[model samples]
Target chain A: MIELKDVYFSYPSGAVLEGIDLTVKKGEYVGIMGHNGSGKTTLARLITGLLLPGKGYVRVNKIFTTDSERLLDIRRSTGMVFQDPDAQAIGETVEEDMVFGLENLGLPVPEIDTRIEKYLDLLGIRELRHRNIRTLSGGQKQLVNLAAVMVMEPECIILDEPVSMVDARCRKMILQHIARLNHEGTAIVHITHDPEELIRCHRLIVLSRCRVTNQGTPHEVFGQLLDEKKMDVPAPYAISRKLGLSPVLTIKALLEELCRSRSGN
Target chain B: MSIEIRQLTHIYDASTPWETIALDRIDLTISKGTVFGLVGGIGSGKSTLASLMAGLGTPAHGSITIDGEPPDPGRNVGILFQQPEDFFFEKTLFEDMASGLLHLGLTEEEVHKRIHSTLDLLGLDHQILDRSPFHLNRGTLRLAAFATVLTMRPGYLILDEPTASLDPKSRKRLVEVIKRISGDIAIIYISHRLQEVVAVSEYLAVLEQGKVAFTGTVPGYLDWATGQDAWEYLPVLNQVMYGLQRLGFDVDLNVACLEDAVEQIRLSLERT
Candidate 1:
């Protein structure tokens, strides 16, 4: 389980996250959403240990997130995929990048090979295994980034704005991959401003000034953001939310409802 | 002012073996004082087209014209990028709004007056004038970016994903602003959501595989969209409403908004 207790984060200017408390059971597919500058990214960093809380504690599985001896374990256990794919890549080629962390881990050659093969196929980037970084499109770059992290085999993945900058088709592809990961019992915490992305998760956590303002299933959080007329919630879902219906999150769900209603009639 | 492009193409990393085509032979036109929308899936060259319109990128093999002249950066074009705050480094909102006008040699007084009026137009109050640009919320920053652009008073305004990540009310306000201000300038709205484009656009273009796959009046593009698989990504409201038609449900085949669809359903029941 992951836990945050009375967490507060303050920058030099002002308090961003204040008096926040939350807990996530292992294998929970959680999503965090809010307007830009809402400190969604700050919360992600805090969980990843990229940034520390000014006050309070962040712990994973009963281990303190800030311990230096436990830091490596935290890093290994929690992987993050940021919005920009270009900023994340340090390898010249896709394959080399996927194995970069494994090589540093000093794993056995066979074990490293096994991990690399597993992630390459998992992210559907096997063809781009030897492709140059700069030549790939934004979607391809994102896929490679996901593959690189998957090769590390972390227990939890935290994605920040994963679909915001990418195109629609690529967004769908990446979102589907995340859904598949959650289904396989690997926890995913998607942090984004896109309403469509927010609705895909089983649960949502919303931050305002770095504090968790609302937390629950996507419907509940989206309900409040929307009742308050939050625009960042995917417009369609928010519109459905506005009209007082359990808005279908995907085309399949919408179609199923259409068919079922027709059959009922 | 209007925008016109013909045979426009862009090649990233030209003169290299690893070159990739971003735009290819794209032909488009935006009439004066009309909101023209560009929509497509990601990597559909929507942003590349926006760059060309904003003069941030050069078209490889095309003639581009905006307001009867070739597009030039820092000229008669004002752009609000997807992340508009990144482009701002001013200490205060007012200063940020005035920077471009000051660069253009406008008098300090003139810049100040325009900044004040534009800020009001965006619904931001005067107290925010002294507020740090970095400390503002996304909705405020999004509005501030528009305010800065309004200060320039460009003949053409290009907004890339202007409504993404905003709250519903903020989105509504932004859309209404676009509608109200579009008649004063040629508006180029680039986005992946076709529903939004359908709502505000007089004309529409869908870029696919670096080419302008469809371009015409909103109705014409809607017609094309209705016939293509591209409609699959439309909002669930549109899909459910349209799906009712496909399944022979009692309703018009194309209800984009839920309120209208609900009313239609009510009326249908009344007639029954």
Candidate 2:
């Protein structure tokens, strides 16, 4: 439901993204991979209407990001979840945080409460409704942020390295929730440096030196990761590729492929 | 010098309503020329333990000794906190790196020489020396922070999630440098990322709820964590091989990097 057509962006120091054209259809999971200073964050900001492109267009739900009149509507359709939970959280409690976003949408009080309950239940964090935001764990806070964003009912969610600082257990938990949301038909544009986080994505886009160097399924793009050296591939995938096995993203898939090969099938 | 912690316990804001026990009767030791990895979930007191080890604060209970001596902050130990850029204050990176060295009576030339050598080891260009630490990118800033700490030439170094927010290139660079300097200086590596921990550390400890849950070598820690149903934090390769064994695959799971894993898989396939 998001598109960037011939987008060119630059900073005062130098050029960032150039001649970029991309589209995210409804219910698609797009994993954006890039190194530091690789314009991944800028691309996400452009799609969410937080930063307008210097050239070309960034459209969300057919609304141009450059259009000030419909900027609010664009943001309402595509919510952004940042890396640090403490920075985005404005409320003192979990319920308050979720409700704060809903209130911003100017929804009725009862409707806001209903939305908060629905998302907390959906994400299975209903028990944390009254917990103090500061006391919550990093993963818990990130989940609260996701809940807050999802409570707004955005068609597409753009997450910018949301799990980079989270612990392994909590990272898995958050990824599971995101996977579920994507399965539920919410388009996701996930910007991450973690290879494990890229496993469940339907499509992988690798950005380097301000251009899209690789774009395809995880298998297709990561198969060349070793040779290209443009982006980092998951260890299992790299190992599988090196071993002449199928370039599988997850360990289970790699084992399945190995088992099939062992069985001569 | 070996750093030792005997029955260490610390409580935040003790004797108050908000008093919380951050650490509890934890005992550990880090010998010289050893890379000790501390793995745990968030708020498992990993940072608190690192602080105690660095002599940032006194333990509420028990004791810590550096080579059988009490801890002296900024003397024999250096700590690289997560987001260490927050610890920077000087206008320029050179000034920040030289902040702790001037007190040692080292000449400006000696400080500059040491900083350049350390930056080279860290794979950082010397061009960023004049720039503000805050102006540099996150990856460069992290290495710069490490430079500031390592220049102190502490006998012991405590790195708290050094690679947490770094990109792949930067993470690889840091990992290489950690491996390079690990032989001369004792390191207490604390991180939730098991891949880096398993790669860098010979000794691994798991912290669960402010207590030492498991402590041993890398392979032993993996087996213990797996047996304890805490394999969730193991690196993907370890988890995969372990899963294969659980599924009746005749494969070795002790491989480290992607290359070793590939060799192991190939050998397993050849046997089958």
Candidate 3:
């Protein structure tokens, strides 16, 4: 639902993104991976219309980001979770922050309440509903941010390193929730540095020095990146590749592959 | 010398309906020249404990002492908070790095030397010192914040989620810097990245509900974690190792590195 054609963006300091071309179809789970200062965040902002492209154009659901009259429609169709949780929190309490967005959307109070409860429970933060957003831990605050975004129920959600602040268990839970949302036809643009988190993504795009250096399925991109020693592959996939077996993404898949190979032998 | 924490309890919004125990009677010891990893689920008190240890505030019902005295953040204890770069108020990075050192009565030459040396240790060039800290990239800003802490020459360092938003290369560089410095100073390396914790820490402590759930060597914690079936909290290699063990293959569960884990799996597969 999001498309960027010949995108060029620059700040007063220097150019951040140059001649970038990308597209995210409806319900597509696209992962954007890159090193720091690679304009990944800039690209996200470009798609969300927070920062307009200096050259070329960005369109969400056929509405150009430059179209000020339709900017609200673009925002309603897409949601973005920032990397820093504290930056996104506006309300004093978790429930208040969640309701603020729904209220802005002018949804009915009953519907807003239902959405607030549903997302808090879905993210396992129901107990934190009344907690001051500032008092919560970094991980907790990040979950609240995700919940706030998901409560919007936008057509697509762009998450910027959503799981980086969370512990392993919480990371898995958040990823599962994101996957579930994507399964139900919500587009996902997951920006992260962790390769393992991209294992289940339908497509992977690697950004480097203001360019899309690589793009393909996770396996193809990771395999090529690993071969070129350009990126760090997840341990399971790396190990499986080193052993002359087809690379698998998750530990469970790696284990199954190992066992099946042994049985074949 | 070692830092000792006993019966430490910290509560937020105490005496009110919103009062909550962030850390509950936590006790631990961190010796010099060791990397002690603190890990937990969300709101498990890792950051609270780190702040208490860093002397950010006093605990409610217990004590934290570094060599028989309260932690002195000025000289002997340094903390790199989650958003450490926010603490950079000086116009230039050099001024920021020198701010803490100047309070120690060090000569200007020594302060500059320390700042330069710290930057060198982190593989940063001296040319950036004149630039505004706000102008640097996220990775550089993180390293600059880290440099500010190290320039003080603290005996104990507390890093809270140091690699949270860092890329893989930056994460590796930071880990290397930690290893190079852990020989001279004790470090409380707190993070949710289990694999990184396992790689860098000699000891591990798991917290749950503000209580210390497990604390021991990294290998011991790994075995304990596997037994507890907290596989979700394990590194990918460890999870694979645990999975292999369940599939009736004899593999080393404590294999932390990828090369070692691969070797262990290869030998186990050959034997089976």
* C-alpha lDDT values of all predictions: 0.75, 0.83, 0.91
Over the true interface, candidate 1 deviates by an RMSD, in Å, of 4.1
Which one wins on DockQ? 3
**At residue B126, what lDDT does model 2 achieve?**
94
Residue pairs with backbone overlap in model 3:
none
Q: Model 1 TM-score?
A: 0.86
Q: Which whole-number lDDT from 0 to 100 does residue B27 have in model 2?
A: 88
Docking class of 1: acceptable
Interface RMSD of 2: 2.7
**How should the candidates be ordered by lDDT, best one leading?**
3, 2, 1
lDDT string, candidate 2, B1-272, tens digits: 69888899988757756566778999887889989998888667888888888888788999999998887777888898776867778888888889789888899999989999988888788989888775676778888899889988899999987887679889988988998999998999988788889999999888887899989999898888678666686787888788777777777767777777777777777877
- Evaluation by TM-score, superior candidate among 2 and 3: 3
In candidate 2, position A188 carries an lDDT of 95
TM-score of chain B taken alone, candidate 1: 0.94
Off by over 4 Å in 3: B103-107
Tell me how many clashing residue pairs each candidate has: 13, 0, 0
Candidate 1 residue-wise lDDT, A27-58, digit = tens: 88888777666777778888888888888999
| TM-score, second chain, candidate 3 | 0.96
Shift in Å, residue B75, candidate 3: 2.1
List pairs with backbone clashes in candidate 2. Answer: none
Q: List ranges where model 1 is wrong by over 4 Å.
A: A35-37, A83-148, A198-200, A206-214, A218-251, A254-265, B253-256, B268-272
